[model samples]
Target: MTTTQRDHPSIIQADGEYLAAIATGRFYPGVLLFRSPDLTRWEQLPHPLEQVEMPESGIVLDPDLSYVDGVYHLLYGTALSASESGFADSPICHVRAPSPHGPWSPPVLLHAKGFHPSLYHESGRSYLLWSEWDHRPGRDSFGGTWAQEFYRGTRRLTGRAHLVRGGARGARLHRRAGWYYLVAGGIAVARSPHLTGPFHPDPHGALVAEGGPGCLVEGRAGEWWLTAWPEGGCALGSETVVRAVDWAGDGWPRVGDARPATGAAAPVPPGGARVPAEPGSTARADGRLPAEPELTAPADERPPAEPEPLTHTDDFDATELAFCWQSVRRPPDPGWLSLGERPGWLRLRADESPASRHRVSLLARHQHQDCEFTVLLDAQPTHFQQLAGLIHYTDHTRWHWLHLTHHEQLGRCLAVLTSDNGQLAAPADPLPWPNGPVWLRALLQHGELRFTASADGGSWTGIGPPLPVSRGFLGVCATDLTGARLVCDVDRMSLRPLSSPR
Candidate 1:
């Protein structure tokens, strides 16, 4: 199966369709949802918690999705604070909706003991599972997976929590053939005859020792698939990967050779259509066989074409910001961002410096691959405090900014400012700017970044020396460090991949 450019993906087959819930990290509109008729293709749905208030620090972690009793339940954890030691207060919250495209219920606080909360349903009862966090010195922080009775109707927990099995970083539970399988850290598996009990680890050790945490999903044909991410460093963050699963004669599950394959046959036949679950039927909830399959193509045929590259332009022609755009820590407030102020332009009133996590006005999208991000900015900064231009941002402390700011020596100028893990540096002198709207571009290729400016969008002049860096979220930003809300009008923005890496 093909991988997805999303983090901490929790997938489930619900209502005859495949639904995936993605961890949004520090971006606002928490918990992105995607729907797929067949596992090979996916389309993003509206965020479930777009209006919910998010924490100002750390990130919104593991979001798990499940379908129970004709309702879509979503469980997520928010890191309220963290230090060198570990997470100080991470609260697990729950919400539900009738459909994947949801009018979700308000979040209900579950527990603060740990994160990566997942839910398991059986025989009209539900259980909450998580990796217990123990912070005492010399103690294993994630030593065991805990399970407790969860009353979904009241949105609360009952009875005492039990240590069911060894600690799993991102624990998920699946029941098959009267045996309960506990998949953890996306690499190991444990089994037990009871829902919560003394579990036995797989004698073979880790299922896929080289992959990150993920969940197990059953295909339309009763075949099980494991979803995971690569363990090594990735420029685009942790992505969603799916691997074929086979059941051993002893009932234990094994991933293919414990390695991630570059390509594999999709779980469903090409162009297979989804068969919605019958209303009031608990068949899907209890691992019952799905209705007869509807195969649109032969099993030997190749899967659908690869998805198109992440390349698009925003002229601010629409009244609403596209779903691709996201803000840090908070949703883009209409108070500072407006498209109606000037038709065909995105009006951004600077709120606070990029370093301020509370109220940053920066809006950016994930950089899936090396591409050129260009923006047309029409701003005249009276002082260095008011700046506007393109930014390749990972977090506040690690980013490269090629902006138009006022300089004491060169009045209005373009300069490159970089922060490598909070150590700030200026790699090039400020280049004097011409007055009217200017075209700013950032070319990212082959682990190196180069900045240039153009007057008419034709002839380009280098603004800074090429700097080696990793790929990150690329977008336009305007900041007012002086606390005097300055304004910057972004006429247009475009992102396209280079023909080939240099």
Candidate 2:
């Protein structure tokens, strides 16, 4: 699937020559048509359909494109009529062209009335299978009522393709041994002698795999496999892995070869991972992803440009988030983030807390393994105490946050990791860096958190003992502790993964 789109995942780098989807800026969904070679390098073909203001209906999923007979066919999820999730919610929308490179047809809202749609053509006629959702509130985020709502409540959209009405997501199928066997997310399988499934569910593949509710399909290599993301897993917001799917003596779909897709012919180093592909787009590595200099943003921050988020540029540049900051608000604020108004400064305005799980307010990307990053913040809030620094957090209430701020008693910028059931956890020791202004450094060396401070970028002072944390995204925050107004001014920041590139 495409990565980096604003709402639905954007298709950034594609198969060397096609750049299907892209982001115009950090805002609005920008779709690009790209071409690539060897999945490492990419080149953007002209734009097919670029929507300036993508409607925010949460009902409409991002549109996906694929080449069929040298022509392009775009499948997107859009709102037919609003409900718990429309027939078009996760269902498929259509846009086609006679040729791969051409003027795309207007998006056709092709769907039956009540199911969450997934587009695929087993035989000749394209099919849209989906589960209709009952989006009324408090209906259990997972389990129970929600399941019942999804089951009984979900009806296939009663439209043209009535036979393909049995879609409820998480389904996959492939060609092998003269069979087009299918598997849905609930771990259920339906077998069809042919593609147009007048299929029957095998008792076995009714439910398997873990994590959360997500759609899956055979891998690029067509091996028995699947990958899942948490329910409402904000499109490509999380790193999803591919796992192998197995089969029983009776052709029942089972989990097998569950390793992720590398987009490359080779595999990633141990513990490293990649986001598997979906029906649309292929993966490419050495392509046009921002020249991530130990984690920095590309100068062209708009569409047609890529950001160096975590690609290892080795320098933070103040404009980048130092790979150690994660957002921690329940209804996390999207506006609470920005980079490069001043080129080398990371700024944080105030934002609302997240509402529940997966809804983090501040921005948190990844930090490398056994690394060191310097974080420097220069700010004094008028209303609330503006806090900014790196973190290794899990959730709003879980994990640890190591940052700099103005402590009430100390009356100076202090370095601390606040983690207590109640009240902010005090610094492991008093502020180590000079009160006024200085460079704060935290090193993740062999699982130990060693902190050092420098008044000038050259000199240094030890903060204290290293803090300990699990392998996770290094977080950063710009919270307004007192008023609804916390802001931070930063001089500079940088991250260096001690190990050399492989």
Candidate 3:
């Protein structure tokens, strides 16, 4: 029998059973903390870093939370963010706290690149095993410091990413039956006991080299098991999977699930084949290997909390900003939109869409890759050109929209896409529906994005071309090149990511 820690976390955390992944707002990546109990059910805790700094250096990722004596130390990867991303360098930052969940100290910058760190103690000094980064010029991957070593101080470890090479991502180490094992890749594997030097990368670098279904865990049997994530994160997706790992006589790790093999290992003929390691240069002397590289990646997010029902709607009984509505990419103008005026209806006083180049009215964003997302609206325009509905967008490089605007007939709709060339017809349906009280929905699965509009909130029709969903943000927006303030009172609007079956 095997035990997998998830919902019931061994550690007691501040937030509830599952954590929420609060976006860092800007490109500053956000983190989710989980309190686990005996490696089973996990609970969410308060984030280590709350407010995103001005210039985000890098994100702290693959946070492996552990306790050293009484204080909690987290080993993680440091990452940088682009300017549009809200950061300057994106180096690896480390923060220490007296408690696992705490008034944590500031980020302790570790390295320029490198990611995913694991802390280990040898003799008396403490060290880290992190994923390495490539320093070589031109190449995008390979050869880094994914080894084992001791850290003397900030960013000063006994060794680099690859004790001798560099470039490691998912590095894991453990002593089994007195034999030491190293795992990485995201799944690369090599072994040694000394914790430094030349590693004969197992022909297969990952502990579970052949990945498919099952969680591969190295429990007591001197044996392992792997659980596969069947469909991965696509279906009612985001599900936690665990399995076992098994090994062959030659010490090879393979999968129990049937999947195609990665093209790395092909059998070449002997004699005419490349010779095995020269008996002399190959050293298995002391079980000592290289260091590990680091990684950076996301949050609480009850791994499976159904997105809260969106609060804002088409009925303007109350005036206020619904928390779910977000403004990322470009800084939003507070003056153009306000909840202080009416009650539930968000007021957008005609303003220029920082995201729009020529003349377009809409402020919205795409959240994830697949799923159903929507925003309900009602707009009052003194002039004619005005619209409110589902819009898709990301950086200035991409965008599209499906909305109902006022034409000669009162409520005319149109769908438009904007690329480097210019805005072309994308999708739109004449709801003949009033600019006020219309529900707009955007359905995006995989890559195809489409917008739908409904007058009575019952029957709906597709508005345009398969709009590309570029992970955009959604919110109430108004464009007034005409200097006309468009009061678009958003009654309710919300975005959602599909989840796996409970």
Candidate 4:
């Protein structure tokens, strides 16, 4: 079944807005950001670091944002994959801006060691926290939690780094009742009466809340709450959960029943702000909820915005590209990925030489594992290695793609190619290319994938047997990507669930 798509949920309350950031790895220009007036209905804001680039090859994972002293500070982890050898460490970087929206400063290196970095501030003191990986032969388990004094304005670390705890991620800190509560992979505590310390785990040393890794936030009502991303919600991706927290007699925050909150609760703000009256419904027309609103209006009269659909269809009818389209690393180069150049069609200029994931002229949307992605491609490739089609891309190392290209010997054909690690699979039987508009579709259900094509948008025909699907996601990445150019016009694209009627 389909599920609400969110993961690595990092959220904080700032500037009277609850800003939530989720990890969108390898989908360059990743990290989806959402802001809610109340806490329930989150609307996606323009990705803050959509244009930020890292050196060489790496993925940006688990970004954290905190607004301090009239500036919004963003920090994220960038490193080569663990599978890659040599200097295996992910370094965290920091960027700041006057506002969460727009004109962020360039990324500056911070700490090095592991991924999933977070920022915590207490009483005018800033701290940068991250996982520490020790890869000296026998340190197999994940490294412990480490912290260092951070200067947001200067984007530099100060003083000596300290090992706060062991073997954890998403390490979070909050102070209450003179206890510095620490929740990393599991619940822990440090009663040092100070923000930074010689912290210690709970006396009981047992997991208080067992569902998933999450952070703690106090509500307007002086009650503490916990938010986590529990697994096994859906086939698509991870889901967000919020729960109430209580303090125990032993001085530890008693995170009540590990079960994720599936119901409404008051938000974490002053004056008792609460979830929206309707699920996924914006509290105000302009996304600004009055401190107090007259609730005399009927539920049916409220804006009937439906829950976000898993499927979307774009016909290239608008002058501007849809917000779903994002480039791999930085902003999409207008020279390669353009809309106005082709009137009603989206023209993607496919270069002959394959470039890095960051430089390809591909615009793609995040796709679930069990969904159908259908696109109408109108292309006329006349040279070898000149191809254009749909890509099931996880990253540069792992992917499966089906494209239409031409060769002097093979003429026009359809090829399905798959790659894992760095080994490439030879393309499958080259199917005879059909004339006119080529409609290509990728049917990914559970763990099975099938590629189909049609002369028209309807009346489809299978190109080959169903191939085993990878846990990877669907995106567009092409090769034969530089030097000479091949233009492919995408007429239309649509995504739908497998069980749903077409």
lDDT of each: 0.76, 0.43, 0.45, 0.64
Predictions ranked by TM-score, top down?
1, 4, 3, 2
Clashing pairs in 1: 144-167
Number of the top-ranking candidate, with lDDT as the measure: 1
TM-score of each: 0.87, 0.52, 0.58, 0.79
Extract clashing residue pairs from model 4: 28-328, 144-167, 352-480, 352-481, 353-480, 353-481, 353-482, 354-481
Tens-place lDDT digits, model 2, residues 49-72? 432233332333444444332344
> lDDT score, residue 186, model 4?
46
**C-alpha displacement of 314 in model 1, angstroms?**
1.5
Root-mean-square deviation of Cα positions for candidate 2 versus the true structure, in angstroms:
12.9
Question: CA lDDT of 501 in candidate 2?
Answer: 23
Report lDDT (Cα) of residue 306, candidate 3: 32
Question: lDDT for model 3, on a 0 to 1 scale?
Answer: 0.45
Candidate 3 residue 314 Cα shift, in angstroms, is 14
Per-residue lDDT of model 1, residues 115-143, tens digit only: 77999877666778987777777777775
Tell me model 1's lDDT, rounded to 2 decimals. Answer: 0.76
Native-to-model Cα distance after best TM-score fit, residue 232 in candidate 4, in Å? 3.3
Best-matching candidate per TM-score? 1
Residue lDDT tens for model 3, 364-457: 4325546567767776544445554455655344556565456566445443444433545434444455444777787777677777778777
